[model samples]
Target chain A: MATVSVPRAHWSGRRSTLASIRLAVLTFLADPQWLIPSMIAPIVFGFVSFELFLGTPDLVVYVILGAGMMSMWGQTLYGSGWATGQDRNIGTLEPTLSAPTPYVFVVLGRILWNVVSGLIGIVLVFVVVVVATGTVPSIDNPVAFVVLFVFTMLTLAAVGTVFAAAYVYTRYAGFVQNVGEFAFYIGTGCMFPIVILPFWTNPIALLFPPSWALDALRYASIPGYVGFSWGLGWDIVGGVATTAIYLLIAGIVFKRVERHVLEVGNLQEY
Target chain B: MSSVPAIEARGITRVFQSRKGFFYQDVTRTEALRGVDLTIETGEIFGLLGPNGAGKTTLTKILTTLLLPTSGTARVLGLDVTKDTERLRARIGLVLGGERGLYNRISARENLRYFADLYGVPLAEREKRVNEVLEWVGLTWAADRRTEEYSRGMKQKLHIARGILHRPEVLFLDEPTIGLDPKSARETRKLIRSLLGEGVTIFLTTHYMFEAEELCHRIGVLSRGRLAAVDTVAGLRDLVGGDRTIEAEDYGFEDSELAAVRHLPGVSKVVSEEYGPVTRLTIRVRTGDLTIDTVRQNLIGHGGLQVRERRTSLEDVYLDLVEEEAR
Candidate 1:
């Protein structure tokens, strides 16, 4: 495609989509029934971590923070992308496409809410875990943890984009949600740590960017935990590097599949 | 020249490949468009007339940048479809068949406003444009009702509003009035004519021959993926030598006499099909001027021949094209 100047009138498309995404996230959070349960999973796990590492005041905080961030990654995948898949299935795909807005912005707008929703889920879990358990981990490497989480989230977004595009072929976004949930369970260690998995399963989990991220978070924030063997912060460095690579790969693959499916006139056919 | 054709196609072609379902083995490739070349100058209503599977929808998709052509090129308002797709899409309006375009869950007003925003209409200008288009399509009264609750005609009217939300320079409407009642169809037709008056270039496709004849400045008859004919209504009618078909009750001409009548200097085709006790031969006049006298004199020479009916219209032109392709 030839490069052309963006139309002046549509310069705000990115902002519009982002705003819509935030609104969708806030709206979902506004409902206490959903908010309470989704947040509880991480805090309950944090309490267990606090009990296991007695006298380590920060263990509870680290586990809760890691779990909360990890849950957000899951929300970005299933929350935003799943909603887009529903629109595609219910025959709103063409109307959305007919608009003059760039396809990228449209897709982004559809799930912008998920990013907000994911953040809300994370915050709620953090507060509950801290207040209820009285656990506060010292901030040893807050910047590093933030960097790792952001990269991990981007990797999940790439996966979500591919899964949503694939929905065009599969005709079911629910399947993407199911796949994303399964991925979250194994890759993000929602139930347990990467070390607990079998040696072979570790490599499989490592394929996803989140595997190293969770390890890096636990290693950086928790006291006396062996995070990476290859020297100072190697796990954090390696995890970031691995996630960047996964994101690049996933982005390229998703775009290719989307183009192929759309060109074949099957984009909206389903 | 205006530097903008409302619509233009240069050697455009689209091919569709069919895949067999699981457990089946037959896969086929169907060519939906075969090198169709066409242009509709700014401010004219051009009708693409064809039967089902005639590639009209494929062409519409290419023009709207929804489907890329297999080969060749198309442009809407000087923007190449493949290259400046985003900009091109912003300027063009398209309405596909039936009530598929409108969102059933939202009220008609919301649907129009949603599209208005998507097209990048400024927040302030959006309301004005939305209201103008809604009133133009006469959907203001039902703007608040969910589209699903609206009748088919009302939904179609809303679809038209959604297409023109941004005042697109060129519009493509495919079979806009296919299933509407006569009153609704007439109202929509009148609305279209008014739009044409305002200099909106329209590329329309319809199965209704009369609608094309009544609305189109020029019509292209597509058949089996090729341009069967492209001309003004009168020009197309003249293609079959301006023939006037005669249908009658036992205007008894014997078989030998019918065969003799087929040999006339100006008569092009002599189709003998069963019609009650008599047979019907849809004769085509090969010459320019076809009067009742010319047809009468030609058939009078045959002793038992009699003329029962005569009507000259675009249907004869369409049938002629279809019959010529069949042969």
Candidate 2:
């Protein structure tokens, strides 16, 4: 038997917790009710109404990619925050703090589960969309897509942490989820084009990485999509960079808020 | 000084000042740990003995690096608790009261393995270590059982196993054995003793004085955010002075005559109960002065006193301590 390494402060428990949580999530996704609607609705909405929304079958590719990314964002946020509220009620957070692993490792372990769950949601969206629309999302820049995907997921996860921290403090999770949903709608271009949002909203949305990602993914997945539009290239680059900065800022802020709430020590108080 | 000890706290204090609900005008202040200083050696089992609302949990939280002390300093393994908390955390294992380990839906073995992973136990050794720790706490028979289905004693045993699973140098057990039956409690105590022999330092807190007496090499009495006393069990007993209780029946004695017996020397407090024109007086006495013949002689003159029972107990000492604090 190999020796077990003692956790240092720098060590994060992401890899291990992620593996276990992923298995649990996959097991949950195997259930029909949860697996079906979240994945199928967006695809069905895309193919049946593709011409209605985008005016052509070629644009079906962008619709599928947009729906897929939105599903990832939504499902990840949902799975990630549920445990935060439950763990606080059970009084497990304080003990987890007593361990050697950095707090981020513990938190990220929770978030990673959401991401994996989000992956399931994404896969379901992909399968349904591919079957319904009969058009696969083509990736022109797979590397950039992968990089932006991770960055977008991480940034959204950070946002989830902020709300989870708030949830632990106030137990008003409804308000937090509402704000997250609103942010997702505006930042991820779920219902509207990012270019069409007011000039001021663009900068605010750009602060989140997903805005640039949806744009980058849209441009990368469908050829001629970018050529159809101009003067928005800077939005993609600036948005990505700004989103990265916002993610860093959000992570720091989340940690501060979480520590403050823990010091107050009223996790389940209404 | 005894190789610098494993745990030390000097004037540790934790204060919480929070705003009022809704109105937010007044800030309520709670002093959870107040100027508490303590030291425990590397291999000794130290107990923090206190009752509910006595700040035992708050002090434990501070020492474990879960909450920062508002004032003073704590060092775990010579590393400052607040500044080097992560380092301190790795070296220590803490089992809090209630079921903090073993996810309710997961099997016991899976729960243990997950913790092993969190502590960075390598994948190859995780299974073996999980089994070993499970067996140590006598939970191997039910390793496949989901925690939600386990009995209270079983959950407690699994918690103990998880705390030791990482093979930490020091262990902090807060109210361990809280919900266990007599048989399970005995086994838990035995396991704790064995761990001490293996050189794992333990810091424990409990409301049960007998549990502390049986397991702790040294103990501290915490009451009302203060360390009332810290010493060996014998030392604490000495502080209260060895005291005893005597219960006797007085045959053919009325209430007025019972007053005479209560006034006897060394009998500090007396309680009388009527029994068919006979009276029974339970007396608290100083240890050296308590003797059956002496009691018999005091009551024999009336020819109505019948000595019934005499016992020296720790509860008497505990009562004295609380009484002194109340005064």
Candidate 3:
């Protein structure tokens, strides 16, 4: 249109997860308000638990873990799904889906960014708990605690991939998630240990990968704690197995979701 | 390059079903596309013209690999659009220009760069290509500005920039100049013409008749989800009677006089319309043998007769073809 000085494109670009992550970072930076709303629940959970666990330094660790897990549940677990929902809102879903790169990689990039933001939420909860109690609860193995903590988030991510596919499957997924988030929290024993819930509900809780992953994290962080088969070995095995299955489910679900959306021709509806 | 048609479609139809009401019991099915068959050779500009509800966008989406057809098949760059979408997507570009389809919060450069990644552009070439497309669309001055701040014309340019960023062999543009200013719209047409030098086949759908006549190598008229006609400008004119129009006006025309004009040697169709106290008769002439003087002589006794002759236009041919299909 103007004086032609620009060159034509060739082959476009190779799909790179790094580039997707960079795009996520840039989008978040541009719209700082996105992180604000997702932060509210974790902070409230932290302070509420801190007040209940008052005067017991030993019990205080659960508050921090609960708060952090709350952040991880919303951000790390379902980040990619909500990001897909956001794509629908912005009307970028059709273009991105029409692109050469697989949509899974785009969701993966969103999940990775969500993991970082989830960690930020964890930090905020930690600060909230420490300031509320004025005492820092101690952990015996900080390295294992941290590793298991991140591992739990990764496990949640595996399950999150399926939910991301759900977002692709329908635009109403966010509403469904909102209606079911509390049920999910209770099922996964996000705040309280699943052991305290009805014994018959263990199977339902075990369906969630984060259930096993979070229990393992608590065992590593809290002292004299016993949850879900009472040891870390089975918890890790269960977490890994469930995470792999969820990851597998994510693959199958994505293929079907893509097909469904294409057939329905509703990618542009939102 | 391969000799296959850049785009080929056969019996492609799309029907959308939606459920409404409180219990979602009502089912409504809309057949957006009927059996449509089309082919466009490499490096050709193919314009699809239709009114509002004419399935042009539906046909375009099927060819672009965005939506699946309810029946039949489509191929772009020799790959099946339904089965080989990923592969076809790499070689084709699409511009669905509107207020949407952009990350509004980010800068235009950021949006292009993100799409470059999605399109799988090489790392070394991404920045250069983004800059190039920005300059090509004449958005170089506003490249770093956020898209939310852009005017509709600027955003339209950004859509074009993204569509051409990947150097697609076939680019499908859906109303690329809808909201652009006169100067910008002219520049966009110029840009579209220049892409032909690089062997890009363009499939454009627009409501503007002048645009189709100006840029299309061949054009298709779609009405009520069915294609009425597809031909070159001259060929299409000939399809609807002829390329010439003759009009005769008077206080009124007797049936015998109208019959006399219709029976004239090159006149194909004679239709009459009343304008207050005047009756205007339109004649579609099929050959040069018919002239105004001959028509007036045929209408012998008519008083205050006015006669005019002019060449037919794409709009005239398009309306005739579409109205035929609508019937």
Candidate 4:
């Protein structure tokens, strides 16, 4: 009997992540209706935040940073997790889960797409606020402010990466995320400073990486800021620490959640 | 090749638990596989035949590493399915050809390319391999069309293309031709046959008895989570009673008349079913000594009677094995 040649299977983290990113781009291009809700909420919140922060001393900066963070939060916090929900809805979860690649990188690729989209959302919020208020806020350090802004989004990705596992853990992840949406806004101080919300809630808000990052963004961009009083260096340290912790938790959760789904055999269900 | 079976399953079982409504608060556990043990040699097509809800898909899913079993062990190509899922998945392929498993918005070529990358096809060979599989499944013509626009048959072909894209050593196909047109289904079968040359072991689950008879080196009949029988088509035919079957249709037949036919030499088993206004008697005979003439003469006085004789089919063998297990 003649033995036939069989190609040995190769495992590449880079290849899987790139393929997942390509899939995300292709899906968004084909049917972009999903981006509607993401866009609509941000535009509404941007206008509302501009009006509500009318007469504060650093009003433009507050409105711009607050509304931008709000809009970007929708994508970076929920969009990445929702993409995992989409995978479950379309029945791609089983095939992707069964593939040789670890599912975490697949979700990582998707979160990266949402991270880019979130940054774009911030720009849209910037334009919307600029057109509404005819005044541009001055950044004390432009490069630091921009770098911190991008870093803020990365902090959200860390949180989103951990949250994306909820979709794999249960089909009701969408419902849970929806219920948590406004709470996310409150806890992360998207529209207002967390210090204004109450002393007891501050500890809870600090648990989220974005809250720390958002505080650091305020210190860098807003002049005479008095929100945390911890200064820029401490806020950055806090952001880095919280984001690293969240990512570590994400890596551990994804493995357990994938194993749990395989054990339960509900990867077929949405 | 290495003397190890391509697939070796030992007492595999899966149980599903479903919880009822809020007021009821009851949990129901249904055992999908009781204890299934099977083995298939490398480069052979092994078909599993069963009625609906007969654990066929459960067993296939367990072996493919998509679902964990409640008990027992399964090894594919010398890799344990549970412990070595990642390593085993690259060496094996699963084709669940249907609308649900595919990315409908993308072209078939894109779907295969993504999967090829996931399977670790070298970047240089990915495009060529994708194109090669598209040609194999006869989807080269519509390779660029969004799969949402393709017919179910076309999607099925694309699925087969993806399954073989990385040249997996073993492929598990769950009802590969379930909803395809005859020509497309035949093409699918032909493509499956061609894979034998590459020494790909195939595990097929299908309700089409003739397909099992035509393609499988051996067939297993699963009944309500248990294996009723496993053998070559001829061996199963002999196990059921014979190579020939005789059918007699009438309004009805008295028990004594049926008993007389049963008492005839070489008659092995007798079964009767109602068809609207009339009843049909299916007689399984072990020898050529029993003929349609003999069956007709046995029911001499029956009116509006029609008699026919032909070789027993796999359907009959399958039905016999399943029904016997039910009893």
Candidate 5:
């Protein structure tokens, strides 16, 4: 046999990351099932809150933010976490995981796309709330609101990555995802203030990254909302600190889980 | 440099655990590969031939770094598969036979572009490389068609295209021509030949005896999770020790007639199976000692029977090795 040497260029992790993100986006666009539910959940919640609040501006703002964030939670759990199971089902997981690119980056890219897709639902819900109540919630700190929103999305993406890794070992990933979607909604106060719940649950809720992010978003978006009265400075500190902590934990857990999966030869298992 | 083997396995083994029953407390372990060692020098097309469940695919997975060995080591391009998985993956490619791996909703071009990106091909060359591969696989005309719309043969071609898209130094192909039509299988073989000409070391696993005999410079036969034999096609045929095969068809044979044929000199084995009205008798005998004429005369002495001497093929060698291992 003849010998031919093909020139190999250095591999760029950033380029592979972008490609994974693009593939995730294209896959989501082609499959409307995930998008339909993400949009409908917020719209339905917005309509219900519109009637219950009787168009009161303060309560309407609460409902809009709650429903919008709830949609994000759903998208993260199903679109990002449960998507690992979908990849296994479609037989693409092994190939994607075995590629030269880091599997963690591929997963991060996927969660990033889910965050982007979830934004569509957030915007649609905001539109529905404004059109129904004829009131746009006044923002006390637009800059803080944007920063907290980004923080919340990233925190959720990290959480989704952790779940994606955990789901690799279980055959009941879909069931787990369904349970997690509702668990985060209730645990993080996406539908209502955690203060209304039992006092003992407050500390647990505060430990979750999304809860702090929600609190920050609520404080920045709704004037006089009952959270972090100290000001936007504390909100930023709390949101960023908690998000960083959650991301740190998620990164460690995901790395270990990914190694276990590859070592055990379970990449093909659903 | 040519002395270094492109692929090498040292006592590689893999075991899978399965849960049994509803409570799931019970665990059953199955050994897929049992200390199997293999080596393929650079630019050689090495074929791994085996029956289903013979650990061929498991070994391929280990060599490709898709599965870790249970208690052994494998290397590609001189890099340990376990220790240098990421770097090893970049230098080698794998094409597992099936239509399931590719993204079904995306066009072939899109799929190839995505994999090119995953392989970290430079942005400037991604499009050119994808197009070149598509053209090589003869799928440039259907490059934009969704893979779900492709035929099985077309999908197999696309699979090959993806495998070679990265221009890896080694490529592992598991049953590349499986389930393909005769013409498509032929085309795939031709593509494999062309790839070999380019100096890509191919580790191929297939059930097709003729394909392995023709394409592989050397072939390895695996049976029951172990390497039964590894040699050139002709060398393997020599394992039967110059045994000649005689196939005869007759309208049902009496037990006494079979016993008479079995007791003949130089006869090693006689296997008879009923195929509708006629019973086919396959007889193996020492070469140069038994001729079709003598065998036909002996059978005809009892009753008129049709007999033909058959050429020894790779299939016969494979069966012989497998049967020897079974004993």
Candidate 6:
């Protein structure tokens, strides 16, 4: 085997993490059109829903939770779901993909930072909701709520990763992202109870991890609300299990799509 | 330096399937590279020259591990491009032409730093390396300015700076100076020469024959997805076998006159193109069969023509090779 002496890289794990954080911040700062809408839309929706429900205690909790979840969903959609496409548009996808570090890690790092940024928005909206509705959200089980939140974010990140991979092969990523967002908003029982919808919709909504995550959050937050067929602990368990499964599926899908893109030489194509 | 070649590609081929319209039914397969074999020794600047669609970019993509070959094997810095892609990427760098690759929103320094991290440059050395490369590319003064504000040449320089952030042993430059002013192109060429002095092996694909002749230690002329010839500049110039190229500037020359010139004794090839007010004609003839006096006299006799003997260039060699392959 012919070999050549090249300078070895001084490998450092921390550098990639730092770089991803910087990229996330830069990307966020660069696109104010997306960021402002992502932040303001959820808060506005929460307020409108609160008023529509006549400021009821139960609906206040529901709308605020929905608002927080939507904030996260928007971030994940643009930050992770459309990430590869954005890189392709910016012409950085090829160079980033060609780097020594695995492309998946770079993507995951971006997702992590986006999630962090989304958390800030979530907290702000929560504060605004509390101030406007004059109701502090009550968490019946703190541990379960925390577990459900973590699992829900992970699940969304996983779904976003799968979407990012799918975006590479198709030109209709923007359309899909828009449709998928509204689909999740309506299907996941964000503003209203999934039970109130058609009985046939229940099964389809159940397939999405966010539905169960929202169910868990609703049960844990609303006072005297024991509406779920499953108990709070069971709902939390279901969300976690579904999220883990989605993550596994996402990992497999991402790897396969990555291989396909390289084989087809479409990494640079818009 | 080690005895091992910096790059080794054997029987490499790439076939792409183009989908007709939106439907996948009427697919057409186009072979971009057909069984290419190449070896570049360590610290050597190898230039690959070809017209468009000659598989120059395809071959570079394969060696850089950006695109996998349909068949055959390639290794860079001792690592198989397909199997050890991650490792090979660490040891090699790629500079694709065009201004689209870098993040225009970020500063040149920031872009270099980001790539350094992606290349796994150590946290301690990332800053120093970014500064070193910025200065190396002569962009240190504009390091903090957003890249979108930078000129085309500056952006190209930044691309080179990013490629070298990891200090790779083998660097692939695909048309490093495609669209640039003469002075900027010359500066880029000087930068590439300095990199060669650092013992970095460069695999450059370019359309500019003059650039290739000046920088490349060896040149490979590719045509129709195959290596037509691989030799030094002088060796390629010898392909014509002592042929002298005579260039003539004339106006109001008809098609019949061009045909008459083509029938001239010992003339192997005649290329004519419009240049502003004058129509420029390039005639290649055997050195012994045709003298400058005879060619000048013939063109003068044809009426309304001015003839001069221009120096033969690698472009003449390239055009002849490509035209031969096309035939």
Candidate No. with top lDDT: 4
Select the stronger candidate by DockQ from 1 and 3: 3
lDDT of 1: 0.69
Tens-place lDDT per residue, model 5, B148-265, is: 9999999999999989888988999999999999999999999998997678999999999999998999999999999999988877866664447888888888788788888878
lDDT of 1 by residue, B27-139 (tens): 78889999989988887789998778989988888888878899999888889887787788777788874756555666778767666667777777778888898889888
Q: Taking the tens digit of each residue's C-alpha lDDT, what string does model 6 give over B212-324?
A: 99999999999989888899887776675434778888775677778877888877678888878788888877555576677666566556667777557898899889988
Error of 4 at B289 (Å): 2.1
iRMSD per prediction, in order:
7.3, 6.2, 5.4, 1.5, 1.6, 3.5
**In model 3, which regions exceed 4 Å deviation?**
A1-15, A38-41, A55-57, B249-252, B273-280, B299-306
Better of 4 and 5 by lDDT: 4
Least accurate 10 contiguous residues by lDDT in model 2 chain A = A1-10
Q: Which ranges of candidate 1 are over 4 A from the true structure?
A: A1-12, A15-74, A119-153, A168-180, A217-239, A246-259, B1-4, B21-26, B251-253, B260-268, B275-279, B284-310
Cα error, residue A153 of model 1, in Å, equals: 4.2
Q: Name model 5 segments beyond 4 Å from true.
A: A51-57, A228-238, B249-281, B285-289, B297-300
Give a tens-digit lDDT track for model 2, residues A1-270.
Answer: 112234432334565556446434543543465554355655554553355457654565655556656666665565556566556655655555566665555556666666666666566656776776677766766776677667667666766666555555566675668666857665657544567666677667655666666676656655555521443366466556765676576567667765666466554343
The CA lDDT of each predicted structure is: 0.69, 0.68, 0.85, 0.86, 0.82, 0.80
Tell me the TM-score of chain B in each candidate: 0.90, 0.84, 0.96, 0.96, 0.90, 0.86
Report model 1's TM-score to 2 decimal places: 0.80
User: A20-78 in candidate 6: lDDT tens per residue?
Assistant: 77877886777677657567777777776667667465665676676777777778766
Instruction: Report model 3's TM-score to 2 decimal places.
Output: 0.94
Q: What C-alpha lDDT, on a 0 to 100 scale, does residue B176 get in candidate 4?
A: 93
Ranking by TM-score: 4, 3, 5, 6, 2, 1
**RMSD to true structure for each model, in Å:** 5.6, 4.8, 3.1, 1.8, 2.6, 3.4
Candidate 4 lDDT over residue span B1-327, tens digit each: 668888999998899988889865898999889999898888889999999999998898889888899999999988999899999998888888777778888888889888888889999898999999999888899999999999988888888888888888889999999988999889888888888887888999999997888889999999989888888999999999998999999999999998998899999999989999899999999976777888899999987899998899999999888888788
Which residue pairs show backbone clashes in model 4? none
lDDT of 1 at B187: 86
Across A1-270, the per-residue lDDT of candidate 3 in tens digits comes to 011223433333225466678888888888868666457777988877777666654766888788777777888656678889888988899888878878888888888888888888888888877887687879967998988987898887897898899898889999888887877776887777889889999999999999998889888988878887659989999999999999999998888899899898889876
> What local lDDT score does residue B262 receive in model 5, on the 0 to 100 scale?
85
Best by TM-score: 4
* Candidate 2, CAPRI quality class derived from DockQ: acceptable
Encode model 5's per-residue lDDT on A5-33: one tens digit a residue. Answer: 66774566677768778888777777777
Residue ranges of candidate 4 with Cα displaced over 4 Å: A1-3, A34-41
Candidate DockQ scores, in order: 0.22, 0.34, 0.45, 0.70, 0.65, 0.49
